[model samples]
Target: MDVQEKCRSWTADHLRDSGDCYYQAVTRTSGGTEVEFRGTWVIMAASHDYLGLSADPRVREAAVAAVRRFGTSLGGSRAACGSLDLHEELEGRLARFLGHEAAAVLPSGFQANLMLAPLLADGSYVFSDSSNHASLNEVIRLGDAKERTFLHGDLTHLEELLASVGEDSGKLILTDGIFSVDGDLCNLPDMMKLADSCGAHVVVDSSHDLGVLGPNGAGASDHFGLRPLLVTSALSKSLASVGGVIAGPADIIYYLRFHARTSLFTAAASPANVAAALAALDILQSEPERRVRVLDLAEQLHNGLRALGYDTGSSVTPIVPVLIRGRERCLRMWRELCRAGVFTTPMTYPAVRAGREVLRVTLTAAHTDEQLMRVLDAFEAVGRNEAEHPR
Candidate 1:
């Protein structure tokens, strides 16, 4: 069959057996947050706006001024006619912010990984962490490098894999600085030591860790004092924008600027996005206390959950996972929480192992103590109800 027919068949099959999924599209008003689905005001605890900079007046003004000056679209790839002053400014600012020699901007974090992996060609081996994000997995699959999976947070496994690679082969060790699902940090110091011993270059994806971890939010590397060969992150998360960046040696960034398919073929980030990211970076740099607040909120939530007898997996950061035994219970709990005006994402199946379904609670600096208490109360009520119902 043709492409349209095949897509229809696949969609039919998938939807036929799909379970109910809940989502709320929120509309912001001057007074409070409103949910389009429920048509009522609701508190938000689901967004990744870690520092609440997304709606900051200064950030919004910067974005607006950029749009007014440069218009909305780049209309071509960066290498062609899309390269603009804003793009260069953002890249330069990001490189300086992260203390990297240079940086290249990509359309998204997924594309950043996808492009970076393939840059390491033949005679190379990619030693990847087991708990890395799916984008990194896709990057490895597309690359020609021989792949080895090391157990998550296990430096011993990583060392063994590095040793297995051929002596002359160039090795790249890739890991998430902060795991997305569990919010646990990678053992960067140990990983760096192992990579150094094996003469392997390290690339860390600090998608979740940036703007929340590290001193002044420089990310996990700054937090641990282990300088990697490269670092990549998304502006969509903590920066509250719509692009990705790869920061490393100046020569490597120049190579990717010219050759990385994602950057060469895709249109440059809009001026507004670049401006917002720049403003966010300035805010992050100026207000070091925001990072501290995020850590404090994470500690408070983790402690509260543990005290209430919830099984929070080994998380020490803003991402907290409350383990639910089964998929059905997980979905039910999620629905119950939503019904009670608590918004959260349910992670299961391919995102995690089948039996490891969880309610992923992300904390942000914008959230107040009262809001967190409400979230804790909602969890307690849901857990109690689930226990009583046994389904």
Candidate 2:
């Protein structure tokens, strides 16, 4: 079949099994641990609210107060005088929280990667991880710089590729702090040491790890005590806010503020959203127990699921993927689990390897022991159900 026909056929096939799959919105929320899907309240094991700050009363109040004061949107780009005090405050707090010299908040994490490409790609050769998110993938493909892809988390492949390029050539390496699909960390300490040996610079997308990793929830870099040249993260995930930020040297951030076209021209982030992120930072600083709690939940689930005979891959983070290995099997499990009132994401081909599909379960700090038990029971029941009813 032609490309369009193939895509249409794929969509048709996906729709046949996906009941309330993609594009289904939550009608109600409770404690940030459960969401209403298809008019049924289901435990949210697929959400990214790691610290549960998204539903915190303090965060809600802060966002509400900002809306009352600033009236919803900023309505223009930061460069067009749409910038608010909250923007500056969040940037400062993120820089301090992540131990960076400076930081600039962008409209979204996708745009943050785009902004960095122009600044860093001008004189560099990009060496990217094969499993890096689509944002970083697009940057490498579209930027002016030449690029190469190393095997996912394979330092040997990276070293070989780096050796092929000139030592004097400016090098930019991009990777995820915690890979969303596999939930494995990047080995930043080793990566940084290798980069140093070759005089290359590294940039990390800490969207999944920031506020959920490290000594004080400082992210992967802090977890390893290595400072990359630049680091980026999305506030929407852990911070329960809507925006992204890049923390790096003051000079680079200054250049991006003036030159990054997306951040320069796109409407500034909403004041309330920025305030919510600020409150999230406060919680990260004060309630370190929240971080511990979430990690403990992740470990419990990871261990429990493995003990029950499901393959969890190599996850060490809140993002755990239960590898069911077939599209039909994965979807059937997802459908059964949802019916059992446990919602999870079934990741099939294109999101994961063709034969390594998974049911992605993302745990949050707000998830209670009772809820966790319920989810585990539901999974066991669903897996048994899947085996009884074949595709």
Candidate 3:
């Protein structure tokens, strides 16, 4: 079938059956731990707000103050007139926090990843992790470079791909610190060694790990005591704000700021978002306990679910993937969870391979032990029902 016809048919069938799992409107939120999802108050496990600072008073105040001072937007791209003091300030703080010489902020994480496309000069080679986020994949597709994809976290496969390429070719290895769908970490220590052996630069998309990993929330690279050639991340995650950052050496950041069409053409991030991110950064640093608390909670949940006979699939991070195997089965599980007063996300085709669907449940520092117990109870109830029905 043609694209339009296929879309029409799929939308009608999918929405009719499982659309509530896709976009249930959240009318209100309390920190990032709970939300009024579709008029029902539920414990939130579907958010990327790992630090639970989105509803923090300080972050809210910072954003509100910026709006009052800057009047919503600067109204142009940073290449022109949209640049603000807040943008430069946030960039500087991010670079210092990430142990980089410099950083550049973008409107979103997708655009931040796209910023790498312009850096792929002729004869450049890119070795990418197969499970990297779609934005990273798109960057490879947009650039005029030879591409080699290695199986997720498979160092041997990565080594083979790197060996096949000419040593002198300008090479950049792209990977996600935490695979979004699978919730497994990249083998950065081994991968970095491989890249160094081949004289290839490495770039890590640490969108999901920043502020939730490492000694000081600098992300996976920091956790491994190594730094990539560059690190790209979304402030929308652990930072509890809206924007993206690319952190690296001063020269490379300067080059991307000037030449990256994605950043040059798009409007700069709003002052409010920049301010909110700055506030979040402060919280991430000052309140390191949030990281510890959230991680502890994640481990608790992961173990609980496993003990209950769920397939969690190699996850070692706050982002947990409960493999449900079938699309309709996954949707039904999501619906059942919601009914039990727990909010979660369901993943199906395109997000994951067909029939290997899952529930993408995330944990935040604000989540309480009682709430966690409730989540496990909900899962147990749902699992019991599934066993009885045998779907």
Candidate 4:
């Protein structure tokens, strides 16, 4: 069948099922841990707002002020007149925050990853994690560099790949600091050792790790007290804003600013987003407790689920995946949780492997202990019913 036929088949199957839980229209939100879906208030457990500052008064005010002063978009790419003082300021602060010499702001995290292609010299060897984010894979493909994949977190496999490459060829090791699907952290310390031995430059896509990892929330690289050659991330997650950043050495950032086609071609991030990102960064630095609380909440939820006989894969980060055996079962569980007033994400085929289906549960700093208990209780009730019915 053609692509359209395949699409129609999937839609028909999903639309006919009571378990279809995709594309929930969130009509309202408390801007924190609760959201109103179809006029019902549900505890949000699928959000990426790790710091829970997306709706913070400070961030909102900063965004509103920017809209008033700048009146929405800059109307062009950064290469033109789109560059704003807010963008420059945010980049400066982010560079210091990430322990980088300099940083470049992009319209999105996807675009930040796109900067990779422009940096790759010819004959570059890209060693990527099998489970790296799609954006990283896209960047490598765009660069048209020779690519090698290693099993996720399998340093021995990576070592073999690195050893096979000639010493003279440029080597780039690309991996996500936190695997978005399974919520497992990359073996950064061991990976770095391998890279160092092979004289390969490491690039960490830290979209899920920034503002959620490290001693100062600088990400996994910071947590390990190691500096990769470059780091890229989205501000939309923990920073609680919209935009992306590429942080690295000043000279390299300068090169990407002028050479990276993605940044130069796409419209610059809106003034409000940049302003809100700045405000969020301030909050992130001042309130380190958000990081602590969010991780604690994640651990609580993970342990709570495991205690109830659910398999939460190896995740110490805010993103937790509750492993389920089948796609239909995962969707049914998600629907049950939604009915119980706890909103979560269901990951099935295409998003995850067939047997690796899961209910992707995430937590934010704003989530309370009471809310967490409600979530666990909801899961417990759902699991009990499923056991009795065997659906």
For all predicted structures, in order, the TM-scores are 0.94, 0.96, 0.97, 0.96
Q: What's the ranking of the predictions by TM-score, best on top? A: 3, 4, 2, 1
Best by TM-score: 3
Candidate 4 lDDT, 1-391, residue by residue in tens: 9999999998887788733577768888896889998789999999999999997999999999999999898999988989888889999999999999999998899999999897666787999999998898888888867989999889899999999989989999999998898899998888888889899989999999999999999999998999999999999999888889999999999998888899878999999999999999999988999999999999999999999999988887888999988977888888889899999999888788899998999989998899999999999999999999995
Which 10 successive residues of model 3 have the least lDDT summed? 17-26
lDDT of each residue in 120-174, candidate 3, tens digit only: 8779889888889999999988898989898888889989988888878899999
Regions of candidate 2 where Cα sits further than 4 Å from its true position: 1-13, 17-19, 120-123
List model 2 lDDT by residue over 163-195, tens digit each.
Answer: 998879898889999998999999888898899
- Give the Cα error of residue 248 in candidate 2, in Å: 0.3
Supply the global lDDT for candidate 4: 0.90
Off by over 4 Å in 1: 1-19, 22-24, 29-37
Stretches of candidate 3 exceeding 4 Å from the true structure: 1-6
lDDT of each: 0.82, 0.88, 0.91, 0.90
Q: For every candidate structure, what is the RMSD over all alpha carbons to the true structure, in angstroms?
A: 2.1, 1.9, 1.3, 1.6
Candidate 3 residue pairs in clash (backbone atoms < 3 Å): none
Superposed by TM-score, candidate 3 places the C-alpha of residue 226 at a distance from the truth, in angstroms, of 0.7
Give a tens-digit lDDT track for model 1, residues 10-123: 888645533445333566532112233356545565667777788778888999999999899879888888888888888999898788999988778887787685566877
Global CA lDDT computed for model 3 = 0.91
